[model samples]
Target chain A: MSKKVKIVAATGCPTGIAHTFMAEEALKRAAEKLGVEIKVETHGQVGVQNQLTKEEIRAADGVIVAADKDVDAGRFKGKPTVDVSVSAGIKEAEHLIQQIIDGKARPYKGNSNAESKQEESSEGKSAGGFGRAIYKHLMNGVSHMLPFVVGGGVLIALSFLFGIHSANPDHESYNEFAAFLNSTGGVAFGLMVPILAAFIGQSIAQRPGMVAGFVGGMMANTGGAGFLGGIVAGFIAGYIILLLMKLLKGLPRTLDGLKAIFLYPLFGIFLTGAAMYFVVEPMTTINEAMMSFLSNFQDANPILLGLIVGSMSALDMGGPVNKAAYLTGTALLSDGNFFFMAGVSAACITPPLITAFATVFFRKFFNEQERNAGLVNFILGSTHITEGAIPFAAKNPIVVIPILMVGSSISAILTYIFSVQVPAPHGGFLVLPVVTNGVLWVVAILIGSLVGGFIYGMYQKYSYQKTK
Target chain B: MELLNKNLIKMHTNFQTQEEVFEGIASLAVEQGLASDKKTVVAGLANREKESTTGFFDGFAIPHTKNSAIQKAGIVIMVNESGLEWNSMDGQPAKFFISLLIPENEAGTTHLTLLAAVSRMLVHEDIRAKLLTLENEEKIYEEIKRFLSENM
Candidate 1:
């Protein structure tokens, strides 16, 4: 009889929540069902548990990296590695495992091997598998962005609760409160873009790549690139760092050690910033025209605008795409235009409100735990929290999507009718104190959300009745 | 015990309180032989509520009971126009409610089927919008049926 082959695996996602564990379980189950013995490692938010040691890696026939975020591929320098997203790990784990067993997998040696002999390169690692790694790092940055979103939003809600809706850019009391809020909340918000860039960079170039990415992100934001620019800057930083790391591969031990940490970051940041500022800026500016076009769209197409904004709000929940729409609308805040932001803020809370209220009104439809979760979702929605919908949307997209669209559209219409305008490019209740018609904006949102929730509940009720 | 039946979706509902919502679904359960009495059904479902909330992810909630309050199995679907306020993990309001009353032993893969169907359809934005726009009981049923058939 032929000897059995053994392999080690790791599974993780950017969120490090359900998908991470789910993939791990799937892979384990698949291996067991296939009559194979496998060792799996998981790096999650609670930290790495059930980790595979060097011995396990060395003994395994091959490694499977099923992750959405960056997993260190350096360790398995010469081992046959099959890299896939966490979703694939969960859905196609057996197939992936089998592929690895058949020796169809490729080896991935960090950037160190990129400059090695061409003859040995085919046996070396590939660099093109960094897309998934970059996505993972981006999610890390977003995970860290939540605190800022909540804190800033709540503070602004408090400002509104205090009835301090200031419109002037030069008021003392308003500025002081704004300063306090900025100090408390803005710092975290400010970190969003840089952190995004840093992690994206880190994914490609490892720990040493963070500084360059962060600096590049800062430059992008300062140069009007915002988060999107930060993303571009991050890739540039990462690739530059990786190239430099490759170039410095054959240096002496001491110099090489210092070069990876200090020299690479220094040069990488300067090069990335210079490149983005000079090369990327002009190219991206062309896209900014799209933003400008959206901003100045006054063709009396309220329905079109509503649909666009509604879709954009739900498309990414709170990612960069969502932020783009939000920022475009809020950018008018400085010019005393709050209508755009009011629409966005309204669109923001409607999904959660509808979900929460539907559970409360129709207890028969929800299981005990889901109804309870609805309450928390509603609270988050009221505060303009959007990520709260992620778990639900992730679990059931069809039901959530329609619910989101209906709720968002209703809110968007209400905001338009209320003429609520926001000046800032990105904020929820955090921008309330600085928004036009803050109280009216909130009222409009509440009313629209009520309508949306009611409609959704009715629809669910009808659908259930017919299903029986 | 199926708490949700085809008639869960009523053309016009007059629910003014939690009891009304419970009664609406409980009657269906009683008729389907899932529950012997409305009060007992309410109590049993309410008891389950003490254990945990029923807000499932993906914009639908399946409030159910396998406990003693139910004598028969039935399902009741409810859709609100302004939507009810429930705490969801996503911090959003729920628009659809799939109330299910299943017999302790009889509620096997059916529940999973329903959950999976809802999850699958919810993932599609266009189909979901069509569901929300659906007004007639037959149309809603067709949508659910299609979703289940395709997904299952």
Candidate 2:
């Protein structure tokens, strides 16, 4: 009789939040379904649980390290191991287990006296594989930056509720409380880009990456390349530090401390700074041209303009394209084009609200957990949190994203037609009183949401029937 | 001194659970005059188990404790034809239960070295496979001693 395959796994995330536990449960369920004997250890905020004993490690056929942050993989040395992000652990646990079963996984040679030589030589060959690794590093940045964005963006909107000029000391209606809120929000916003770059770098080269990444982000800010510039700088900084480590690898063991403290930071900053100045200059120019194009776009046919902007906003759902549209709206707000922001805001809420609506209408299309998530999306959407729709879109991107984009386009066009204007950069329904043609703004959002939800629900129903 | 002597090894035992296997081993430790009391030794093993399960994959468990109830550091090795149900990480029953009892002050010194040695010994597939097939306690002890002396 063939022996039963046995595997051990560890799951962890930076926040030690839902994803860590979710991945653990998902792996367990998948293993059970696949008839594979598996053990999972979770490195959570509470610390490690269900730790793999030394005996278990020795007996296991393979290991899976599903984590966002660094994990001690030393124990799995000489074992076939698959190291991946926690999200992959949640979504592709079966695939990972199958890889181990098929003997496709590489043997993990951790940093031990005998193995470190092989590890270093292999590391020299590949800095890291592309695709998944790149996404993991980028997410490390985005996850850290999100809290600042939400806190700052909402506070800035709240200050506007007191009046657009209430935070200005020279204004007739200047309020100390409004000023405090505005300053605090501004401080958070100021740190957002730097934090994003720092974490991305940290994911790559640890502490040394953070120093270089922070500098790169500051360069982006001063250089006016915005968030895109920050992303480029982060990648450049991380890769440069990685290269430095590789180059200085032959250094004596006693000088290892000097490499991290002096050589890495010094060389990393110098290279990243040069790249940002020389290479990133064109990016800032393009960004400026895009802003100008957006400003000039007001004279174009309103319906066509609304369609393009709305589609762009919904295309990636908080990704680069979405950020571009949102940034354009914020820039135009400064230039006093309030209606541009109104269209942007209307489009932003459409995806999540439509997702919620679809979930409620076509009950059979969603599972219990998803239905609950859909319910939560309603509150998130109403508050202008477009990220609420991300889970739904991520699951069925091909069908869901296109439908969401169409609905968002329709919403934007309607908002433009109704001449709705929003002075604030954020706050969905909460800042409704400050919106000119507020009632029409609400009407445009509802109409777009209903249209999008109906189309998505019909598609789901048809697919479900076909599958049945 | 040889750790897994004939006196400490039990072959083809019928214990059917982790607790039961541990109880049988603790009593053996007392019978061999290596432990002060059977009850205290069993309680120590149970307490250690509560802290973390020592059950490993491929039907092996090493439940251990460092307590004042032990007169000397010793290992009790039990081999069962039928595996005992254990709340192991891999969810597999354990057929080989190696219980260790050490005097409190000597916890981290000799006891830890022996534990490490045992761990290192078990990591080899050939050694484990050979050990599993040996039905005689004297042969099992000889096999373990030869492997450890050669490797360690």
Candidate 3:
């Protein structure tokens, strides 16, 4: 028999979470069945494991690198290599292996030591479509930004427990402990935009994209453009750096070092700053216009305004639409309009709670695994995590999403009609003391959850049975 | 391991139905002493199929099982040049059949790995195209061996 085909692979992700190990396992499993000898190196949160030796790299037929972050591909310069996203490693390991086997993979020609080499050119193309790439980059930024928002929002809420004036340094009621909490929380919140832009840039242009991205984010903050502006700035910074890299490809080898350190950042920061000033400045106006429109709703029937905002919050269950509603509310919070956020919070908390209630009331509609997931939604919903409803909606979107939207809308309407105002941007029942009308907010949430759950249960029972 | 030799493979098989193809491979395994109790093995495979179809998008099916009747972990491959009806997820009929038999206790990691390997290999268009051209049993076995050893 001929000699065995040998292959080496690497896997990594931004969070070093489940995807990294999952891809490694998938590659190993695929290799075994194909009767190919293979070794996998995983770069996880705990650090690198099963490091590939130089001998193994030289002897391998090909290399496969599945990573979300930048992975050094210089070691396999002469070898055929296929680079793909971590998800592709899990879903299409066999296809990738076959590409190597068929001699369809490209040779790695990237200079690993050169920081100025256009990182995009040497990198493997993303396996997903354009839409998927955009979504992935956006999520990368959002995931990194969440800790700052949550920590800061919670601390600020805690400070309010000592009396709202306790955080104001000029107020006679100012307490030292409350001031400390407020200041620390303010610092975390201050980092939120910059971190979001930096990661988004990192996702697009690798390490070099981060500097311009952070600068753009800071500009957005200074410009008063908020979250929406941060997103635009991130994309701008990433693409600008990517464009500069491509443009500077013909530079002399001796000057390669200058392109990354001197040229890219200098031009990147200048262009991104210009874009933030000229282009992104207009977004702040749009944001102000949106906030004003929401504020004007106070005069145009509270119930209708509540219905619109509430339904939007639950529309995608923490997806783009939901984030848009929450963003509007948060932006308005800085404008000193807390009533809109009160409606948003109420809407956000109802979907998962309603789903949990449905699972208990209509157990026959859900499978064992789904019922267990439903139970966990109680905690998630109580914490204002609308994403807890995603699993249920994904399974039967036709029935579940409409129910959630309607229920959340009812909650928002009730909260608005009661004139409830929430000063903080986040925190479910945990920040009840800070709400202007806490008891009514609870009443609205419960009513909405019960109505929504009852509707969902009945629909599942009747519709599913008919289909069967 | 000569687990996949001439005895475990049939080229240009004429079976018109999945059931006929499965039964043919099961009997061959029993005849080759790779498995015991052909009836039990066939039934176990059918039960596994009931849970989920093994048919993949690239015109191949891998129906595998671990059963008490399987005395060893082995694979039986059959090629149907004309292709046969299969309820594949991608709605493609299966042309290459790779059926596996493993001892019940050995069906954990090793069995799954082997199954994954075979499934992934057959999913590739180039490999599937190459597989369809080889007409003789020896050539088919050689191809399988080469694929298992070299192009994983």
Best by lDDT: 2
Query: What ordering of candidates by lDDT runs from best to worst?
Result: 2, 3, 1
> Is 1 or 3 the stronger prediction by DockQ?
3
Candidate 2 structure quality by residue, lDDT tens digits, A124-169: 4344435445656777787677567556756765776676678889
lDDT of candidate 3 at residue A302, scale 0 to 100: 76
- Listed per prediction, chain B TM-scores read 0.72, 0.90, 0.87
DockQ of 1: 0.02
- What's the best-to-worst order under TM-score? 3, 2, 1
Clashes of each: 116, 0, 2
Worst 10 residues of 1 chain A by lDDT: A113-122
Model 1, CA-based lDDT: 0.63
Off by over 4 Å in 2: A1-130, A311-341, A344-408, A421-431, A434-436, A447-468, B1-152
Which is the leading candidate under TM-score?
3
What TM-score do all the candidates reach, one by one? 0.45, 0.51, 0.51
The superposed Cα distance between candidate 1 and the true structure at residue A292, in angstroms, equals 7.1
Model 2: how far is B141 from its true place, Å?
A: 33
